[model samples]
Target: MKKFQVVVKCSLGIHARPAAQIAQACSNLRAAVTLETDHETAQGNNVLEILNLHAAKGATVTVTVDGPDEEEAAQKIQAVFEAMGPKEKKVPVLKVAFFGTKDYDRLY
Candidate 1:
């Protein structure tokens, strides 16, 4: 088994999009992959399991690969994490209106 650690830098964390990409990548590989974050461990090929991790941005995650293509799997996953930019705080967009106020307008 081969093990390595990587930090999740995607602004959205390990949400659906990233999880799907990861799962697909793992599915295409021959190695068995596992991802660990906090007390949670997920199969790399399982998108739902990966999403359940809810790995916040900037969290350091451990990736373990075992089987014939361990090295390649590790490298590919590492590259994916590295490609995502550093964690960022997401800004919330809100719209408010005052009752009976004709001048009310949406704020950008």
Candidate 2:
């Protein structure tokens, strides 16, 4: 058995997309895994179960994995959580200081 804890940092928290990714990974590994919030524990191999956990931003959860490939599965599970964390927007923030300056900044 292996265990790892991750605190969610996604902007909108843990939603269906990330949950589904976790569930698919767990199912592919054929490992028994569970995701636990403060008071609820849900099977990691099921998308609905993970989504139901309702882990919001800054929430911490522990992932437990038990199987022949427990270590590998645990690592994958941790990666899944890490991948779900909030990422910067692809479009760069353009700042145009045209109020006092004559030249406007170029847009990306």
lDDT of 1 by residue, 3-44 (tens): 988888887899888888889889999899999999899999
TM-score of each: 0.77, 0.79
Q: Candidate 2 regions off by >4 Å?
A: 90-108
Taken over the whole model, the C-alpha lDDT of each candidate is 0.87, 0.85
| Error in Å for residue 39 of model 1 | 1.8
Clashing pairs in 2: none
Separately for all candidates shown, the number of backbone clashes (residues 3 or more apart, or on different chains) is 0, 0
* Clashes in predicted model 2: 0
lDDT of 2 by residue, 1-108 (tens): 888799998878779899888888888886799899998899988888888889999999998888899988988888888898767779879886534433443332
Q: Model 1: how far is 54 from its true place, Å?
A: 1.1
Candidate 1 yields a Cα-based lDDT of 0.87
TM-score of 1: 0.77
